[model samples]
Target chain A: MLEIKNLHVKLEEEDKVILKGVNLTVETGKVHAIMGPNGSGKSTLSYVLSGRDGYEVTDGSALLEGEELLEMEPEERAAAGLFLAFQYPVEIPGVGNMTFLRTALNAQRKARGQDELSAGEFLKVVREKAKTLKIDADMLKRPVNVGFSGGEKKRNEILQMAMLEPKMCILDETDSGLDVDAMRLVADGVNALRDAGRSFLVITHYQRLLDHIKPDVVHIMADGRIIQTGGPELALEVEQNGYADILKAHGLTEAV
Target chain B: MGAAVQKSTLEARLEGLSTTGFAPAARKDALARLVAMGLPGRRDEYWRWTNPADFIAATPVPAQAFDDSDEAPVFEATDRVKLVFVDGVFDADASDDLALAGVEITRLAEAPDLNWASGLYGTLEVAGQTPVARPLAALNTAAATDGLLIRATAKAEKPINLIYIHRSEVSDPILHHVIRLEEGAELTILENGPAGARFNKVMEVDVAKGARFHHVRVQGRDHERRAATAIFARVAEEALFKSFTLTVNGVLTRNECVIDMVGDDAVAHVAGAALGDGASDAFLHDDTVFVTHGAERGESRQVFKKVLKHGAVGTFQGKILVKPGAQKTDGYQISQSLLLDDDSQFLAKPELEIYADDVKCSHGSTTGAIDETALFYLRSRGVPMEEARGLLVLSFLADAIDEIEDEGLRDDIVGRLEAWLNRHRD
Candidate 1:
């Protein structure tokens, strides 16, 4: 469902290159886990795919369901079923959480030429989804993540993923600030959406998240490129021996 | 700076204007003060940020009335005692019956007996004249043609809403109002509409011991209109006074609020939200506020927010003064502006003076643009760029809008703000 062909990216304001000749592809209905050390350009790939600013694509292209995502605006990418779960959710002080979600849903619907959902209808559906994710009614009524805790924010992201029902989801360090219980709750939410029609790109440093939302394929990314590809066992190898051994086997000498 | 030239300046401005004598003593005193102070100019320290030329011009500059037919009249369906004014004249036929329980309403145009209003009409205006002068308010008191004199003796069942309508292209209207609440009485006043081509208004409120007074106003009319308005209020012991104004799309607007907390444990809050867009050099908004704490344990808060674009200019001058004996006073002031582009500008001056050492007071001012990270987050959620920016702008004004006591009135104001943002979306 998602494909990347030799995506080369660099910081727009700086001369440093981040993703140097990176290529990857995730088939339909599959979960791909990318394991990398710090500053290995894993997050840059997700940002470039989601059409975030501050990054210039020097060469190559990213396609989502055969549509070029690099040429589309962020909202258009979202309407075309590309979702990026941010590492840091924004805090909007005055916009209510429910209103923000409803606006997003209706906007995507309008962009897709679908009828908008009424307030009442939207409320019923949101309440049901929020219940399974353990988000309380007060959290939904408050301003969008203004005073939410880490766990609540991550869960809120999962709730958006579920509501949007995107074709391909990219989890960019979603487990960074979450506790173990929060991680389990978030993984359960992601696991619930696993099916034959949706694909996910799980980016992480540890294999703990993969143990919950088991991936079908695992790839080791080093120096802005995938140097090793294997099954789920590869995640265990990286967790057990660290990237030092992987880098050594790949004829590279870099400590992580 | 000769006395004769000052007199001529005042005379030229007040030419061809006559009104029914409401409070002869107060009006005479106000005229004397206006003559002494003359009119504000760009050289004045208080008027440096915003020139008073439009307000001081001899003849009202003509303005083509803004077409607001697409918007529903604010507070039209609310349950309240409605009073309508056209070009500063009271429209008895267009207004509801001037009778309500627990309150007394007197029209200034009828030359009615001032009764309790005789001493309280311009008392606050005169008292607030020290240290700084507000000559425009003095002019309004001296030349205003008509307004309402309302006194609430008990808790009122409904709000008192005054709606102003503009129909003349060259109407120059000056209106002065007096509001008094007796001990333990409660009242809320709502004012909206574009009054005239050039509008000058002043409201003086007397909140008695333990009384509560709330005022919410919307200064909107034709986009080309120019207005200068002032509110002078005195809060007694244990009394509460709150006033908020929302300004949208005027060539020039200056709203000044002066409040005095005279008794212990009194609370006062003055806040405003202004949105301006200037295609030329016509849009400028200024808010000048002064709050004084004179008693023990008094509390005062001033919150003002502005959103400017298209080279529109906004200015804020606010001060909080705590007297020598006003120990345990708590005062807070904040002024913030969101400039949508490089062309827009915001100027703010926040001051705090504490004669008492045992008081807590803080003031802050900020000018910034939209948060780009937040913008990207919203866009990633599939919200269009314009709608996302509009949402953020409304959020920036939430602090000022929250000062309103009524939820319905708050919703009405939000609806109008949203409409303004949608129309100005670029």
Candidate 2:
């Protein structure tokens, strides 16, 4: 359902290239895990796909169900069924979380020519989703992410993803800064949303989150390029043996 | 109606004042001081943001005669005891003399004696020191005919509301009110400007030790009327004073507030919201002085918010002063404005003066259009642009309106604000 062909991205000010000919494709009903060390351009890929400003797409293209996703605005991309669970959610003071979420949801609905939901109906749906996600109703009343703890912010991100219900979801370092319990809870939330005709790309540094979601395909990336692709057992192999041995075996340690 | 005419006519009228009062000596001295000051011009430091002389010069109408019409108040169903004043004169028939446990409500002219009147009159006069030497104040003192005086004795448990309603027709009317809350006493005063009338009014409040005073003023005059009012408050040791002014209408409106935190451990919060539109020019100037005379732990805060649309102009100027040896003083002032239309304009200046080293003081001012993200967010939620703008503006002014302690008064002001928004919404 989602495809990225030789996607290349570079910073505008400098000659530094962040993504180098990265290629990935995920069909319906499958979860793809992209495991990478630091500086492997995982988060950058998420930003570019989500249409965040200031990221220049030098070459290649990204498509969601055969529709061009790169040309849309950040909000438009969100409406086009592309969701990026941000690593760091922006804190908007004086804007309540429910107010923000309702705005986003209704904006997408209105763009698609759908009838808007009443406040009562919207609150009902939100409360049900929030209960399953272990989010308190009071948190929805507060200003978005202001004074929220690290784990709470991440949970908020998942809650937003569930509310938006995009066709393709990209989770960037969702496991970072989460305890073992929070990690399992978040994994469970993601697993529940996974279904036929919907796809997910879970990006993480550790194999702990992978144990719960159980991806079908695993890819290891280094130096802005994907170098290895294997089954789920490949994750445990890399967990026991670090990336150095894998790079040495692939002859990519000295290729650069 | 224009700036030039407003300025010239006000000048001519001030030049023609024939001063007469019970305190003729003080009135004459104040008039001479006003003449020397000669209606603050743009060149003056304090009047830079809003020039009353210029506004008065254009629409120079004579002092209005008393209108005894039984015009009902816009805010009905108020629970607090009411004292209404019509056309600068006290309305005895429209008010109730409630024998509350610990309050006193009486007219200034009918006080049997002039003891309190003599002491409270001219208390807020600048005495030729500052540029805001009270030209309109002098006009009120010389021509006020009558006013209301509500006093709360020391440690009074109950609070009273003094309501002033202006009713005028062909001329501009003025009213002067003085409220004194003695030591440990508490009172809440609600003042509403008359609709469809030109009003120039002044009110002075003196708060004593450990006393608490709450004042809420709502100006909802018709767009054709012009209104100018000044509020002066003096706070004593361990006393708490709060004042809120909401201006939602009038062709030309200027509501100025001066708060003096004179005693140690005295706290004061002064806030206002000015919503203007349709060729209206609403100016709000807040001059607060935190005098820390050996009274440590004095605190003061002021916030002013203005929302302008349809070529309206809103101006806010706030100043906080910390005197020498007034250590441990905390003072903060912020003024923000939201302009809805390209033709609308907002000017803000926040000033802080500190003579002591151990004082914490900061002042900030910002003027801009509504947040585009917030606007788009609301519009995307099926709310029309005008309604969305109104909601945002309401939230913007909520910071100031929320300071009012009385729920009735707060809701009254909010209702007036909504009415103003509905009138100006496109």
Candidate 3:
């Protein structure tokens, strides 16, 4: 459902290339995990695919179901069934979380030429989805992520992904700030949204998140490129042995 | 003692007023004050940010009514006793019978000789003309033709709504209103509509001991209108005084509020929300507020917010004064503006004068564009760019609108603000 070929992206304001000659694809119903250390161009790939500003995509193309995703605006990407769970969700002071979610959901619906949900209908759906994620009424009422614990923010992001029901989801380091319990909870939220038509690109530094969400394909990314690709066992191999041997085998020295 | 000064065009306009009818004494004193101060020039300290010359210039700009769709003025949804004024004259035929219980409303033109109102005609304006000069208010007092004299003996059964309609294209309306809330009395005064092409209004309020007064005003909607309005209030012992003003659009608008907390343990709050879009080249909105904590344990707050876009200008001049021996006084003043784009501008002057060692007074002013991160976050969630901008703009004004104590009234004001945003969004 999602494809990336020879993608090259660089910081727009700086003379540095973050993604170089990267190629990846996640078929429908597949969960792809990209494991790499810090500055491995993992998050850059997510941001580029999500159409974030400040990135100059010099070469290659990202496609979603045969549609050119890179040419679309950030909001257009969202309406095109693309979702990115931000590594750090922004806190909007006066915008209630529930209101933000409803606006987003309806905006996407309107962009897709679908009827918008009434207030009552939206509230009912939000309550049901929030309950499954263990997000209480209070968390849904406060300004988006303001004063929320790190884990609550992650959960809120998951709730949004579920509400929007995007076809391709990108979790950018979703487990970085989460504790073991919070990681499990977030993974469970993502698991509940899994279906035959949905796909996930889970980016992380560690393999513990994969243990919970269970990726179908594992790719080891280093130095701005995916160096290796394997099945689920590849995550355990890196977790047990670390990336040092893998780097040596690839004839590259450790970054540090 | 000295020879009478020469008159400028604005001064000549004031000089031509027919003083044969109203309180000639008050008009004479006010006219002298205006002449002494002369219309505030751009060089003057207070007028540096907002000039009255364009508003008070002779041969006023030819009036052209802004064609807003027919909509009910705010408070039309509420049960209020409506008093209509058209072209500065009281419209008795369109107004409700002045029979509100616990409240007495008299036309200033009919009762010009009444001692109660004449005593207060220019009292607050004169009292506030210390330290700084408000020559335009003095001009309004000297030239005003008609307004209301309201007195509340007990709790008013319903709010008194003053609706000003501008039917004349070239009308230059000057009006002054005097309101006195007796001891233990309570009243709510609601004013709305664009009065005329060029409007000058002054409202003086006296809240007696233990009285409660609420004043909510929504300025005219005409984008080409020019207005200079003042609300001067004095709070007595244990009384409560609150006032809020909302301005949508105008060529030039200067709203000055001077409040004195003269009674022990009294509370006073004055707030305003102004929205000026690209309605005209010189769309200017100014709010100049001076709040005084005179007695012991007095509390005062001034909250003003402005949203400007498309080269529009917004200005705020606010001060809080804590008098000596006014121990335990608490005062707060904040003026903020959201400039939607690169062209819009916001000018603010905030000051604090505290003579009491035991008082807590703070003032702050901030001007900034909408948060881009917040904007992107909303847009990323699928909200359109314009709708996202609108949401953030309204959120910025929510704090100032919250100063309105009544929920229904606050909602009414928010609705008006939303309507303005919908029309002006780029």
Q: Highest TM-score, which number?
A: 1
How many times do residue backbones clash in model 2? 9
Clashes in model 1: which pairs? none
- Per-residue CA lDDT of candidate 2, range B1-426, in tens? 556544454456555444564556555666666566566566766567665653455334433333323334544656666666665566678876746556665565665354565666766645313534556666666655566666788544444555555445544555667778888988877666552255667677888999998877766544454666777778889999898877765556666677777788999888888777755444333332222223567888787888877777777666776777778988888888888879877776667777888988878888888776555444423344665676677767877887888776677777677666776667
Indicate the worst ten consecutive residues by lDDT in candidate 3 chain A: A247-256
Interface RMSD values, listed in order for every candidate: 0.7, 5.6, 1.4
List the candidate 1 regions with Cα displacement exceeding 4 Å: A251-256, B1-7
TM-score, every prediction: 0.97, 0.75, 0.93
lDDT tens per residue, model 3, A170-229: 999999899999999999999999899999999998999999999999999988889999
- Order of candidate numbers by lDDT, starting with the best: 1, 3, 2
True contacts kept of each: 0.78, 0.03, 0.54
Candidate 3 yields a Cα-based lDDT of 0.88
**Candidate 1 lDDT score at position B35:** 87
* Candidate 3: tens digits of C-alpha lDDT, residues B184-212: 99999999878888888999999999999
Better of 2 and 3 by DockQ: 3
Residue-level lDDT of model 1, residues A42-90, one tens digit each, is 9888888988899999999888889899999999999999899988999
